[model samples]
Structures are given as C-alpha cells and as structure tokens.
Target: MGLDFDWTDEERAYRARIRDFLRRELPPEWGDIARHGPGSKEQTDFSRTFCPKLAEAGLLVPHWPAEWGGADRPTWEHFILGEEMWASGEPRGAQYMNVNWIGPTLMRYGSDEQKQRYIPPMAKGQAIWCQGFSEPNAGSDLAALRTRAVRDGDDYVINGTKIWTSYAGLAETCFLLARTGGADTGKAGIAIFLVPMDTPGVEVRAIPSLIGHGDIHECFFTDVRVPASSRLGAEGEAWSIIRYSLANERVGIPRYELSARVLEEMVEDLKQQGRFDDPAIQIRAGEAAAACEAARLLTYRVVDQKARGGAPGPEANVARFAVVTADNSVTDFGLDFLPDFFSGLNRPGYLAHHERAIVAGIAAGAAEIQLNLIAHRFLDLPKVAS
Candidate 1:
C-alpha cells in the first residue's frame, strides 16, 4: 500500500476543534501554571476541573471504545488531540496517561470488577494514577526490578520502593509492578497490580527536580496488602502486557509538536532581540525545525500503524529517539541563543521546555535503550556478544 501523508478533512476539523476548545477554556494564568509542568500540583489540580469539562465536550478519550465513554473515534483523531494538548502545555495533566494507554490497558487485561470500579472514574475524568514501575536499580531494565509481592490467601503483601514516580504525590491510585515468581524467573516472574494510594504502608515522598513540582517522586510500599483481585492480569503475564502498554506509551506524548511550538517561540524571541540576522543562529534554528518535523513524521507512522490495528514494533523505538532529538534540539537552540530567558521566570515556557528536555532521554525509557532496539530490531543488526 502507498503511504498517504494527507489528513482527512474530518481529522483536520478535529484538530481545529481541539485548538478552539483550548483557546476558549484555558485560563489567562494557564501559562504560568503550566510552566511547572503537568505533574505539578497546580496543573494536576487544574486538570481535575479541566478534564471533566473536556469529557463533557467529548474530547478526553475519543479513541476509546463507546462502551468506555469514548466516541469510538479513529486513532488519528486521538493523535491530533494529543498533539494539540501537548502543544498547549498539556492541560489534561496526568490524566493524559488514562487517555493514552492505562485506561485501554485496563480494558484489555483488567478484571470486570476492576474495569467497572476504576474505569468509570477515569472515563469521567475524575481519576489520577501513578506508574510505579521504576526503582533506583531498575529504571529501564524492568526485568531487574526487586519489588516483591508475596501471595497470601486471597491477598498479596507488597514491599518495595519505586523511584522517579511521576504524580505520585497526588495520584489516587498506582499501577504497580512486583516480583511474584522467584528471583531467577526474570521477566516471567513479574505481575501488575492496581493499588489504591490510600492503602496502608504506602508512602510517597516528593523529589525536588528542575522538571516540575510534584513531577518525580519516590514511593515506598512496606508490607502493603492488596487483594489478589487488584492484580491486573494473570501471574507471569506482566511482561507481555507491559510490552503492549509501552508501545502505546512510547509514542503517545507527541513531544515533537511541543518542540515545534517552542522552536517558533525561540525564533520570535531571537527576532525581537535582533539576533535572527546571525547566519549561524539561523542555521541552528532551521536544524531544530527540521528535527521537529522529522520526529513528527516518524511518530505519525506509528500512529498510522495503530490506526490500522497493527501493533507497533521497533519503529516506535525509532520514533521515540527522534522525539528526544527534537526536544533536545529545540531546547539547545533556546539555551544557546536565549540564555537569559532560562535563568528566571521571565520565559516560563522556555524554562519549562528546557527542564522537560533535560529528562527526555531518561523518561518513558532511556534513549540508549531505544538506540539498542533500533540497532537490533529495526536495523536487524547483529548483536555484540557479551
């Protein structure tokens, strides 16, 4: 089949509608609030109100099945929604995870009880969830995770610590992973749990960082007890489920859309300061724009595959790396030419973008991992023997 680059008229209209909604709904102070990033308390609090309104307007989960409160809209429409929200500093906040992957993952693997109890709140935009996946020792290598969940009667006792958990300080629930099989089981030993944040022995401590307030955190689960019913899927099934979820997550952010917007803003700033005439700066800005577009097209390929009901493959890895490159390129251009803006609150957007760019390589998954996947899976390169 031939690759079609054009968006349908309906898709264009959907994109326009999202932009219109954002323009009409966002408060004047939104830029200031957004400067702290999506996981900040301000943005998280704002989303509680904002996202419900989005749901009321039928915008929160358009790609979801009608049974789940969405319109059963095409995937491209959902991708457009993501691009618009991300470009607008992600007013949906942490709930974007629900719209992007978590809710869908639950629908696929969650028990009927889990779906009825949890998904309704999410569909109504009244839920906040944190991903308890990474540990200090297992950031990208999830198979190496040490968090243990021992089965006890009808319950499981969980004891482990998660690091760099975003939105944990405010999330009402956690999508946690734990080791159920013996230490030797590797990926086959893992299990997923949907634990309520209010459960006993759950502790969350905020970690100060440049990304945003309340963004990254350390969560401790000591003797935390949850019913077996809370487990997302069958024991030893987490690796497969996680692969599906990460494919959705890896390309969901539309970070290049945000990067492109920030690049335009940087160019405007340079123009105002009479620096656009500099040939070297102009060339760098052009390179950043090209990077953003390259990332955008690569991401669209993955989205198109999803639209066709095909599982994303290593192309998602390539797209993810392209996005990181775009993010860093735009931020690097801003810092190199507009250093003054990043020093203080004057250019909150630039400051916010810079902070996110700093962690772009690390968040979602490490960029190095993406490169390895691209080398082995995408390029079909021979692996180096250890």
Candidate 2:
C-alpha cells in the first residue's frame, strides 16, 4: 500500500471542529478567497477581524505551550489545523511572529518574564508583532545591518531603519534586532528587543510592493527607548535565536490546496475558451497537478518528522524549493488562457498562474538563496575563496 500518514480518529475529529469554526466564524466570502487567495500585498494583510477571532478560538498558536496561551496540541495537530485552513482557502490570519517565529524563538531563548509578557498577548492576538530583520543594506547579507542600540541606565535606546517589514504599519510591536554593542560587533553585538509600536520616535511607512499591499512596510526607529528587560535571551546571543527561528520559518511547508484551487479555476477558463483539448496546455496542466501533489507530500514528510520530535533539517528546504516551482508552473499554465479579443492582443489574467509565478520566486526565500543553502549545508560543498 502507499505510505499512509493518516490522522487518527481523534485527530480527524479535531479537524472537523476547526472546519466548523471556520465556517461559522470566518466571513462567508472567505471560503472562495481562501482558495486562490490574495498573493498581492494589499490582500496579504490578514483580515483584521479574523485574527482576533482566531486567537479567541485557540487556533493561532497551537504549537506553543499552554503557559503561553496555546492549545498545547502536538505538532501533527498543528499541521492538521494548517491543512484545514489552507484547504478552505482561508487567508492566513495570524502573523508568523504570533503563531510561529518570535514566540517560539522567545520561548526557546527568552528570559521567563520576556516569554510571559510577550507570548500570551501574541497568542491572544491582543498584540501584533512585526519582524525587524531586513534592511536595504542587509537583506541576504543580514549581519551587515547598521541599526544601533546603546545602553542608558536600565533603558536601551535604539536607532535604525528596517525595510521589508511585513505588516508593520498594523503591528503593535516589533521583534527588533539592533546593534546593542557597536557597529563593529558584527553579529555578536546584536540584541533582540520586543519594542512597543507606540514608543516615541518610532515611525512606520507603508512601502509599495509588486502586489500593491500595505502588508509590507518600512519601520523606522529613532531614539526609541525600552527597558533592557524587554530583550529576548541575553545580549549578543540573538544571532543564534534568530537563525533558529528563521530555519523553521522557511520550513513552513507549503500545501498545494491553494494551487489546486488556482488549477481548478484555470481549467474552467480553458473550458470556456473551448481550448481544453489543446494538447500542449493539457500537458502543462498535468505537470502542474503532479508537481503540486508531490510538493504536498514533501511538506507532510517534514510534519511527520517533527511530530515525532525530529528536527526540521536540510531536507525541509526541498518543500520550499519544490512548492514554489509548482506554484509558478501552475500559474504559467493558467495565464496562457488570457483572451486576445478584448484589444485584439492577449493580456495576462490577474488570477492566472503566470501572475503568481512571477512573485513565487520572491516569497519566503529567493530561489537563489535556497539553492545556495542546499549546496553548502546539504551537499557539503566547499566554500570559495574564504
């Protein structure tokens, strides 16, 4: 028989509960939007109403410990929840920091109070957190960031600008990394702080993305002050914590349900155009179908390993690489159906696979970075001219 990673009867029941909640609590319009969901910047903003409701339903942070307001379910349960939500084409309502990134990273490395103060509100959706990691000068080379923070009595004053801050304009706090030691401290001087969004001298400006969403912003901090007690873990250890969290962030294995919805729509469009029998288009569509299924399996494999307490290692990158390709391929196939009769020339359909493909390469990690990681870390390739 084929490999069976079927959920237990109890797990199945739990999923049904989540499904019922989604049906009752989520906006009715969300069902269709959940599939073929917004990839645009404007659309990426999780519906504000749904986020707090998700928190109320105990669905936002299932992977967290009970002390942190999570349901404390096993990892497989978390996967099931993700599957059900994605399968519904539910807009991913919770920001990653509250659900995955900073909270867990904090639980792993934060002082007890830091965890106590930050995690619960995040899980409850009473607070929204933005990541302050990337900068114009320090994206792929993140350690080169020039943001500075200095000690003054018990308070740390921060001054820096962070770009590509997803949803910062709407966030209530930021998991900010700043040069606590000095500009020359390299990665060693970095410290992670949970800074309130309303802190004086902090500024947020929406930045335009290809998808034209307010979801991405540029967050600026000028002399922002916070007590040192707000720091996550100890001074100078932020490098490891951030790295560990990001590894899991990238490991947020993609599900094909969303792409499958895209495929279904494309097929309908093709049928309407009376070109459903086109051999080349049929072949392309078939390839996308196979790729999407394969990507889903790769993602589930990672979940299986983690459910049993295994680490998400290098193999997890396979999911990121493959699924992105699958999404792009599916998009390419669908966009080809754009009718030429409107202006006597064909134009791209906004919802077509092609539109998604162009942006697929940018999400999570760029393809080049993923390949480099696989090469050096997985393949054990020797570094050049170090």
Candidate 3:
C-alpha cells in the first residue's frame, strides 16, 4: 500500500535505519493503542517520552531546522518516515505540530525568537500544540469562525469557542484563529494566536467521538488575555495563512494510512471468505485495490510539488478530488455484498463506520468544494450568477 519511489543510496540507508529502529522500539501493545486510541494524558505522555527517542535516533522532524533536534532532511525522507510509522501502526509520537502543521507554519512566519522558543520543544515533543479553527457554526466554512480577540494595550483579550479541536484537551498550547476586526471582516480581519492552554479563562471539554474516542474536543476561551507577541503573523494576515496551513492538512498522513489500511482489510476479507474466485467480487476488489494506489500517487504528487517550492492550486485540487473520490468509493463496495458479510461486526464502531466511510467525500472538504476549487482556481471557470 506504500510507495517504492526511486531514491539515492543515502535515502535507502535512512529508511533501513528507521526500519531497524521500529523493530526495536514499537511496543507490542501498539495495535491496542490504535484501536482504542490514546487519551489526553496517555497520548501526551507517550509523545513526551517517545519523541526524545525519535530525536536520539535523529529521525524527528526531518523537515525542520537541524538546531531544533530535527534531521533537516529533504522531502523524500519524510515519505520514508511516514510510511514506516504507518505500516507499523506505531504511535504517532513525533507527528506533533512539529512535523506536520505548526512546524511548517513557524518556518514560514515566526520571528527568530518565536522559532527558537517553540521549535525545540515541539521537535522533542516536550510541548504539545492543538489547533483552534472549527466551531459549532463554522466547521466546513472555516472563514465564518466567531472567536474574537480584542486589543487592550499590549494584550489581546480573547473569547469564543472552538469545536472539534484536535488534541486540545491534551495540548499545552493552541494555534488559534479569532476575529480582530468588526462585522464586515469576513475572512479579511481574523487574527491567529499561539495561546497557551494553561492561560486563565480557558476551558477544555472533551466531546467524545462517534466511537467514544476522547481526543477531539471543544475549547472555550473567555477573557483570556495574552501579549501581542502571541499573534502568529501580521494583523489580519490569518485569512491567508489559515488557508495555506489548512490546505496542506486537508489530506495528509490520515488519508494515506486509512486508504492503505482499508484496502488491505478488504482484500484479506475477500481472500479469507473465498470470494476472490468470484468474478464479480474479483473485479470489484481489483478496482478497490487500484483506487487506493491511485489515491496515494495523487497525494504524493502534492508533497513532491511542495518539496520543489510550489503552492497548492491545480495539482493539489486534483489530488484531493481524485483521492477523496477513490477513497470513499473503494470502501463502500462492501455495501454490494450479501448482508451476511456484516455478521462479523456487532460493535457500534463498525456498525456506524460502515455508513460513515461512504461519506468520506463530504467529510474533510466535500467533493463539491474540491470540484469548485478545481474549476474556479485551477481552470479559471467563471461563476454563474446565483
């Protein structure tokens, strides 16, 4: 389910090193962790403990500056690191904001002092960061976020709620978006802040997932004040920064790992039940397998383009659209099977997951949105009058 892209002998050596490390370090309980998921305390504690292990092995944050406990390697190394982590189902201890989202944003916009203060702890997983973007009213349409931050001298007083906040219940700090300008702001006047969760007037309430996973949550801030230095970039620049950071994250490791894992499961189930010999099942299963591979290829293309210092426009849109379509469709063929096929799953998780998996096209960003971006931004299509 992973790639075998051609790489230099050095890249090959590095991948071997990672394999060696995982063979040594991954706990036997790794599968349990993946199934039940880690708690706020457990996940944070594990990351805090394991991150240093990754750093000691020189495999942490390969995309970041070397001074901050990172390998500072090129883009290809990232693929090896990610694939190794995924295939083993190891705890994603090092993927803290350091490798994926926050580190990149800091590299793009942080002051030197901000970088020094944040990057080292993140690289070592000694610190945890969460994102404050989604709200009850503004998830898919993220620009409608209602969190507010008003300036009072050198301090900005913030008040609002962020729902479905990833890891917020566990994180030490959050990179948050809040409105700084009045009613007419729309997307233009929102400001982002790097606010510590321990700050007064902040509350984290765990909102358990559809399957009872406690990681995602709702974070509330009321009269939480921080120095102006907490802001991520220039005033009102967040609209653009948020777009860039989020566009990168819309589909990354989760999409890759889930697609690969699901495809493998489907093939194994078919083989075990002796359905592989059925021409109908074979044709359907083969298409599912190929589609997973296609999703990975399209996703990696965006990662490759970014390595060469390109933005996400046409290529990213195409990848997202194709992958989302392939991902959701490939899994729902289970629906084509006899009802007896589902007898193996009596649990609430699988019972609900069957339906939810079909909606992947509309989950992160809808297929409709992906298509619109492709047309308006990539193909320069004119909007029809509403």
Candidate 4:
C-alpha cells in the first residue's frame, strides 16, 4: 500500500507520446463529436474511422499480445491509454470495450477459431461491440436473466431481450449472455455467446432518453440461431468467465479522469466569470477535486495490482464506488454554481458531463452492488440469509 508517485522515464515518455498523438490527430470537431456522447451513432461511426488510425499508429490495443496485433505492452500502459481516452471524452468510442475487456476476455476464454475470427478485428480497431448483460428484469441480478439458448443440433436458438444496451443500434457484434442450463442451474448453467447484431431475429430499438441519442436501446432476440461455436467457453463456464470479464471491465474505463478534467474546466469557467472568488464555490471545488483524486488513487491501486499480475479483488469495487461519487460531485458542482450551463447558455461540455454523470452510479453494475461487495469482501461482513 506504499504510495509511489513517481513515473518511470519510459512511462513518462510513453504518456507524452500518447498526448502528442491526441493533440495532433484529434479532429477539430472533437468537442462536438464528444458532445454527441460516446454511444451515439455519430461517435460510434467516428470511432470506426478514428480507431484504425490509432491502430496504425500502434496506440490501439497496445497491451494485447503481439499475435493479436499488440506490442505486448504492460497493463499500466493499457490503463494509461484508457485514462487519456476517457479524459478526452472517449474519441475511441465503443471500440474501448474491444480493447479493454471484450478482446481480453476472448483471448482468455475463446476457442482458437473464435480468437482468430474476433480478436483481429478488435485489434485492428474496426470492431464495435455491445454488451448484452442486462435486461429489464435481470440487470443488477444478472444471474436471474431469462435469455434462453436452446441447442438445436449444431446451433442454438436464442430468445430474449436486453435493455439499457449501449451502442446496440450501430454495433456490429454483441458480447452476449444467455442461459444454456436448466431451471435449477442458476449461475452455473449460464453461457457467453458472440452474436452478430445483423443476425436474423435480432432487433434493436432505440430508447428515448436523456442520456444521449441512440445511446441505450432495447434489443430483442427472437429465435435467433447461431452456431454452437459462437459460445465463448464451455457451457456452465460462463459465470467464471463473466467474473473475469467484469473484473477487467470494471476498472478498465478511467471515468474519474474525465470527472477530474471536467471539474478543472468548471473551475476555470467560474474563475473567468469572477465567481471562483466565492469561498463556498472554492470549498466545493476543492472537495470535488479531492474526491476525484481519491478515486484516482484507489483505481490506481487496482491497476497496480493488475500490473503486478495480481488478481482483481474488492479494491476494484471500492475504486468504482469512489469514481461514482466523484462523478456526482463534479456534476452537482456545475449544477449548483454554473446553473446557466445546463440551459445550453455557453458550456456544452457541462451538459455532456451532466448527462453522462447521471448514469455513473447505475451503469457498469450499480454503485450499490459495489458497496455490498465492499461490505462482504472488504469488511468481511456476513450476509444475512434471505
């Protein structure tokens, strides 16, 4: 737990190079692209173009194995890239999932054929993936999902619906989960599937919402049949794979980096308007910045553990909850002091941040779930029997 704040020269150099690349390559309209939101069709489509340039520059998926088009960089470098992207309003868009956990999950659990088919596109930065983990009835309690995948000789017929699916409207593939086990199987019987979004019986309907345009959707799979080869691992192996994926995915995005950057912008805006001289505003700004720093350190601990080859643990949950707090704090500060920004008066970034912050606690497996994990795992508290 000793804090080492100094970055190695190599790490510093790498980070500088990445920053330079972003400054040079990010389009002039990047702010507007980002304002459209990460899951919006504009950003997703933009990613299809932007990400390949990143891959060509050897910046995309640098942590992946060399065989999968990466330079085999360290886990810290991978997280550094994520922090930069998130802070930059995620110009990489939905492809971040491909780099973060989806590709890694496939690398760990996919069959050789599956890896060959899927990992290359992801590595090339030409893939957009949507996660089908939540449904209206089974979001937080994912094991309670009713998505069924029945074996029919060489294929499995999938029938179910997934709600709150981001980037579903334009994604090329879905990192899907469905039940392959019986009624009594529970988590053990669940399995992962790589389903093509263009497959017959797959329907995506955009849900009208405040978060962003085409950001969330209702995805219905009606008797969709895919080859059994689409399954990621063996049947009954999904829970473990999912646990692994979630562990990687949870800390993958450095949302606190974005929150911290937004706070800085808000503070600058207030200062320019002569409002930062107020004691109340300054105190709240310090509190929000401190929250962001606390979240950053907690998240760095998780990344440090990963860099040392340590497995994910309750620390990630703690970091995630801290990030949610940071997100809300920054959002609230804007709403409290810079109220006119919400009305599209002058700052569009504030509105974008507000829209995204609203879902920070709910998305990526709710903040409450993380608190429960902290209680049971970190605090070693016993769970009450239902």
Estimate the TM-score of every prediction.
0.98, 0.86, 0.87, 0.98
Model 4: lDDT to the true structure = 0.91
Q: Candidate 4's residue-wise lDDT over 108-151, tens digit each?
A: 88999999999999988888899999998998788899999999
lDDT of 1 by residue, 1-386 (tens): 65589988888888899989999999999998898778988999999999999999999998889999999998888999999999999999999999888999999999999999989889899999999999999989999999999999999999999999999999999999999999899999999999999999999999999889999999999999999999999999999999999999999999899999989988998899898999999999999999999999999899888888899999999999999999999998988899999975678888889888877899788999999889999999998889
Residue pairs with backbone overlap in model 2: 34-89, 34-90, 35-89, 41-213, 42-213, 331-353, 331-354
Model 2 per-residue lDDT tens digits across residues 185-264: 79998888888899999999987654334556788899998998988877899888877776676655354666776677
Q: Write one digit per residue (lDDT tens) for candidate 3, span 40-66.
A: 455456667777888777777776667
What value does the lDDT take at residue 320 in candidate 1? Answer: 94
Ranking by TM-score: 1, 4, 3, 2
Give the per-residue Cα lDDT of candidate 4 at 87.
90
- Candidate 4 or 1, higher lDDT: 1
Provide the lDDT at 182 for model 1: 92
Give the poorly placed runs of model 4, Cα more than 4 Å off. Answer: none
Per-model tally of clashing residue pairs? 0, 7, 0, 0
